[model samples]
Target chain A: MEMIERYIYAVTQKLPQSQREDIGIELRGLIEDMIEERVGDGEVKKKDVEEVLIELGSPREMAIKYRGTKRYLIGPELYDSFLIVLKIVLISMFAGLGIVFVIQIIIDPVEILDHFVGLIVTLVTAIPQVVGWVTLVFALVDYYGGVQTKDLGLDKTWHPSMLSAIPDPRRRIKRSEPIVGIIFYVIVMVFFAFSSNFFGVYVFNDGGFREVVPFLNEAAFSQYMPLVLLLLAIFIVKECLKLISGKWTMKLVGYTVIINLLGMMVVSFLITGDAFWNPEFMSDLVKSGIVTEGSEGYQIGETIWKNSTRIIVILLLVGLVWDTIEGFIKARKK
Target chain B: MNEQEHIDKLMLELRRGTITIGVLSQLSVPQYGYSLVTLLNEKGVQVEPGTLYPLLRRLEKQGLLESLWDTNEARPRKYYKLSKMGNEVYEQLCKEWEGMVASLDHLIHTRKDEEDGND
Candidate 1:
């Protein structure tokens, strides 16, 4: 009887609140019936009850059968989508990290091994972190019985005519590419805005390698910081839009061309103003024996220093023209 | 893998689908979980008490079976019988089952004939 009570308790404990009492009473009656059938006119014994309970099987297993199907952290319905999202995130993480590792190696060729080792460590840690977070988000969505792919607005309004929305393979942008671009752009923007000294030439001086003499005049660059920030914001927005659409269209191309032209104009304005370069960088070059003061090398260096703004402006215009042409070409591609 | 295990697996699958019909057939009379199990086993349809009790509750919940608790004896017992809906459903299911068995029997015989001809 005690064993029966324990078994009933175990089974009922797993059941929903409203069904517990009814199920407990019903289970007890069934157990008593089985014991009565086994003992006949004899007094009911613990051993007889135990045997009946054993035949009934584990209380947890019985509870689960009553509960219909098993619960899952991520169920079958959302499993395909979960796997898709996980694959995209993991692959993007690896690719983005790989690109950064390559760029870091290029920037400091001496530390190539160190960068490679760091990349491996980052990938090892980041893969599981990304996978775990994605699983957790999917689990929460599943638990809440949130809307599925079939319930999407696109599914409701879907039509044969909308097949055009399926991007052409030739022109289609892989989503990870835009995401990686955005990440790279953000990193470059941050480095330039906060650590402008990193842009200059490194030289061994005094006892060890001294900080690079900054190429851009910090005070002068600070004045145009708002424009620089706006340009960065525009690039970020464009990349985000590209990621969302997963393909190029006329509108996106137009947007890219307009932003690039505006950026080129801003660069031209900064260059022509003659306040962009650090006046001190020329002296630092002479002191470092990079160029002899008043020598033929100094004359060439001076000429370069005076005409650098015009050279940069020409380069900016060329880049803008190339970008505009490339944009139209991509937009026109099948 | 072996012949006996293969047969057992096939039988398990066949029994899973037919157990509901077997239970419904015997529940025209009010029977408790253990009694229903005994009756089914006696009729050569073996059902575990674990499977039978939960199934009875599920059928009742689905409005196919109605239950009553009788405390007349020293111990109380919940007896289940088919509801009006249950009876109609059971009859329809029985007809469907008979049709399925007949069609399957004909298909099997036709296949057997082909195999015999080939041999």
Candidate 2:
């Protein structure tokens, strides 16, 4: 009896809950009728039930069969549409987070980016992220009818409906990646070289660098930034590609965003010059253990939240140009 | 049989079956799913549940069938019958089917006589 019930539940598992109980009962009756026709009625016991089910086929297959075919937009129909929306949303979310981070950075002890640049950056990041998320949700809902099971693992053949992802064609001819990578790399190298003490801008220029950097308060940020900025920008681009192309090849974009934001707290300390290590900040978090880095958590979150916004836009524009160029080149060849 | 032969059989039955006539004739009166299934079954043509359901859905989607959920009963069921457009299409199918049958029958019978003489 238990086996029979298990067999029935297994078949009905794929079906929606609303229909499961009734369908289960009706199907069991049908199965019983078929069993009776095959064997004597009530002669079959629990041991024979599994055999009957095996002959019928896998429960998942039966469930799929019973649910008559329905066309999916993400499958073959609106696959291109899905990619367009995913790009827009992922970029937008990044932008929104960046604005919030910038605001927090400014509000904190050290101020950077003259008021206009700061506000502009904040707004620029906020708008697209909001728009991207809105469109993404709307498009997803319209296509899937409010049933989405988007898996974001890095290793699988599982293509999200949006991931009929074709390889970008211009990867060969354009060679923009290397140049862009180096430019980004150079930016980090410059930041670290001057920010760190050895070739100190402040020491040499007698505080000339102080006037240029709107906010530079922490020693660690001063020390770590050259390495940090290069890493952050490259990571952002990688995350955006993963998201837009539906590659599942890395950590969740959210996780990356949060982790990178921690760099902001490191910067926040640079801005405030609040010592290399805040014992109270570290100890309370380590003691209360709510978080090992309490105030610093807000700082990282703020950084991520701010930079993500700009990074989102930069990623989208770069990705769009990259894809478009790749697409154009492929089209020319074809 | 080969695909061609199967298709020929299906086409022949469809031509002779008077579905255009049967459908249009029935649509003059409002009919629902179970009622329509019963009507076809009584006429000695059996429509499988899967085929009937999908066909009904497709027809409704195509604006050829107008349907509304009639939930007054203990179990809610959707009733479907032809739309105004479906009526016109049904008329067209009836005319086309008659013309096709007349031409095919004339050819077959004439060919049969020729073959008989040659034998």
Candidate 3:
């Protein structure tokens, strides 16, 4: 009886949550029937139970047979797109890293060997992080059904008439667009989350490359980290919508506009505020000799630095407008 | 790889479809999983309990069968019967199966005659 109970547990544990209880009950009854058939009026021995279980085959195989189909963390529906997005993101990471490496080597040729080693180390470390994050996002998107599952409420009964018309091929948003958007969002999110401390001014000296002036005030940046992460998450969700829809819709356009508006507000609040910027940035710039003191170049640089918040905000607005326009244009297509 | 193994593989494939029909045929009248297994085996269908249980569940999920737990029995037994839709489907499937059998029988008999002529 104990062995039978263990065997039932083994099979039912592998099954989905909803089916487990019913299946467990059915299995228990079935096994008991088989045991009775074998033993008749005699004692139900452990050997009879063992024989029955052995005939039923391994628990893993039984579970799989019951499942009817193989389960995936990122299921077959999203698997192809996941692979494509993964390849693109990894290649982009390599390219981005390579470009940065080249620029660094150019600045100070003496540290070429050290910089090459550093680049390799960075690539090695970053590859896992990138793969992990992409997989996590894709797995979550797969589990949650990407975009359409958001409004899948039990209150509304489905109708055949509610089925969307076949989209025009030309009107279909290319999958690469959303994939690239997701990749970009992931990269930005990763950079902000894990590597924000590297956002600093570096200068080479006798001590090798040193961060002479950190651009972000660590205390304040950490405080705003959650908000920054939230903004990126919303952006990723919007991109997920684009991925799932694979075509322009009014709903998607509206979502994109609202998300962009929300993002603009949050981002403006984050960057334009004193909490985000290093107060000593201008002084640090002068001290580092990247910007000179009391010269024509210095005067222009100073003026630009003084109104940098406005410039940054304007740039964000321009980007927001362009993105909104693009969404509307795509949605308007036949 | 070898003739026996090859034949066995083909034979398994052959039995797979027939097993579903066999199970559905007995299921016009409600029967519990173990009883259905026993009935099928007694008639020489030879389905594994492991295979039949899952197949029964799968058919139920497809709405070709409906199940109810009869707790009145000493041990609670889940009884399954052909649904209204299942009955219609089974009838249509039986027709198709008969057509296939007739066609195959003709083909096999003709092939045997050709082989005899060749000999």
Model 3 lDDT at residue A226? 85
Top TM-score hit? 3
**How close to the true structure is residue A144 of candidate 3, measured as C-alpha lDDT?**
67
Task: Give a tens-digit lDDT track for model 2, residues A1-334.
Answer: 6776887898788887876775575456545544554577557865577666665677776676566555443443335545544444344444434544444453442555454465567557656654554355445544643233333333376657846445335322333443343334333343343333222111113432221212223454555565455455444444333333332222333433443455444444443454433223323333433334447775674465457645754574455455444434443442
Candidate 1 interface RMSD value:
1.2
Say which docking band candidate 3 falls in: medium
Clashing residue pairs in all predictions, respectively, total: 0, 24, 0
Question: TM-score for every candidate vs. truth?
Answer: 0.59, 0.32, 0.77
Every prediction: chain A TM-score: 0.50, 0.32, 0.72
Model 1 lDDT, residue B76, Cα: 76
Arrange candidates, best DockQ first: 3, 1, 2
- lDDT per residue, candidate 3, B1-119, as tens digits? 99999999999999997998999999989999999999999999999989999999999999999999899978888999999999999999999999999999999999999999999
Q: Write the per-residue lDDT of candidate 1 for residues A1-334, one digit (tens) a residue.
A: 5687889899999999898988898888888878888899899887898898898899889999898854678777668757666665566556656656665655567898898888788768867776776687678767654444335544868777755655667678787766666566555554554445556766665655644656788878888877886776566556655654467788778878888878888877887777788878778888877777889998897788768746776876896788667667777887
By DockQ, the best candidate is 3
Cand 1, B chain, TM: 0.93
Off by over 4 Å in 3: A13-22, A39-43, A64-70, A94-129, A144-219, A233-246, A290-292, B1-14, B58-74, B83-85, B105-119
lDDT of 3 by residue, A134-154 (tens): 788888877766435434433
DockQ, in order, for the candidates?
0.60, 0.04, 0.77
